[model samples]
Structures are given as structure tokens and as C-alpha cells.
Target: MDESYFFKLKSVAKDRLSPNGEVAFFLGILLYSGALLGICFFAIYYAVDFKKTSELFKGLFIGSGVMIILLIILFCLCVLFEKMVFKIQKIIGVVTVLYTIFIAYFPFFYFFIYLA
Candidate 1:
């Protein structure tokens, strides 16, 4: 019913924040932001090039391909830090559950925000 009721990923992420874990989380945020920015970059770069449904499909596939690559890269980094992650697994568990709840809230969240 309210957008303010939306869950924050940061809150759970914060509870798990350790010096090293913070670094890894920071890295995730960094990579996440970078990947997002890179997507925006290419999306704009090809804005004029996608003139048809076929081109739009090509663009979508390319964007998805890039996202998959980024996810695998991030996954490897997470594995590299797996030893540290064990300590934070409980926190991550809560984060995951909260994230699932957050997904459900997102439509209401965005709809209200859009109205605002």
C-alpha cells in the first residue's frame, strides 16, 4: 500500500558488513554500478542503430549477453571470497528473503513513486 514500506537491500547488506565483507560488498556495488553504467553507455551508443524489431531483438540479446557475462564474473569474485562469506551466510540468508519480499513490493513501489 505504501512505497515507503519497500524493503532496502542495503539494510540487510549492512548487518553483514565486516571489514573484508564490506570490501567485497563494496566490490559488488562497484561492479553492479559499473555494469549498469556500461549498459546505459551502449544503450545510448546504439540508440540510432536499432531501427527495427530485429535490431531491437539484437540489442536485447546483446544486453542480456553482457549481463550474463557480468553475473558470471561477479559470481567468480564471490567464490573467491567464499571463505569470508561463511561468516555472513546467515545475514545473506535474511538478505535473500528480504529481497524476495522486495521483489513483490517493487510494482507497488514503482507505481506509487511514478504517481508521486
Candidate 2:
């Protein structure tokens, strides 16, 4: 028999107009690093009160370390191309900053709640 027109392949063009989310990724990096630096500063400042705030600083350190690890993992994923960058990256960074801030002041929250 004869195969006149069976199947055909079409060439696909690259999408040049769409955003690559580099801005989001850079913003995430900025926010993550800034928060981490702030945590370090607070931990250092509270080191003088070793008796009362040691546990608080310890928790902050641990939380910051975990956050750093997670951000590193995200960086690696971005490098691997397995996941494309998006606004969620910036949201993650913002959430990390907020979460760390909340954790750092947890003891104060307890104190304020107890007072009020």
C-alpha cells in the first residue's frame, strides 16, 4: 500500500515575551537574607540575658537555620529547572520573614497576653 499523508510534525517557537520570574527569585533572595541577618542580630543582642532569653534565642537560631536550608533547597530546584520560578517564591520569602519574626517575639506575645 502507499502512505500519502499520515502524520506531520510542527515546529514550536520559544516564548520570548513571557516573564521568567527572575525578579521574584531575586526578591526572594533579598528578603530571605535580610530576615536571616535580622535574626542573627537579635540573637546576638539577647545573648546578654543568658538566663531568661537563652531558650528564645536558641529557638530563633534553629528556626533560622531550618529556613536557610529550605531556601537553599529552593535555590537548587531553580537551578535544576525541575520547577519554574513564580510569584510564589517571593511569597515564600515573605512568609519566612513573617514566621521568623513571630517566632522571635513569641515570649513577648505570651507576656502581653498574660498582662492583658
Angstrom error at residue 27, model 2: 6.3
Q: Give lDDT: candidate 2, residue 72.
A: 66
Candidate 2 residue 42 C-alpha distance from true site, Å: 10
Q: After superposition, how far is residue 109 of candidate 1 from its true place, in Å?
A: 0.9
Candidate 2 per-residue C-alpha lDDT over 16-93 given as tens digits, one digit per residue, 9 for 90 to 100: 312234434434654756564565546555653434555655565566567556666765665566246454556545
Give the per-residue lDDT digits (tens) of candidate 1, residues 32-78: 54555455445544663434335544555465446446545644655
Off by over 4 Å in 2: 1-19, 22-52, 82-116
Off by over 4 Å in 1: 1-80
Kindly provide the TM-score of model 1 when superposed on the true structure, using C-alpha atoms.
0.33
Query: What is each predicted model's overall lDDT from 0 to 1?
Result: 0.49, 0.51
Query: In lDDT terms, how accurate is model 1?
Result: 0.49
Best by TM-score: 2
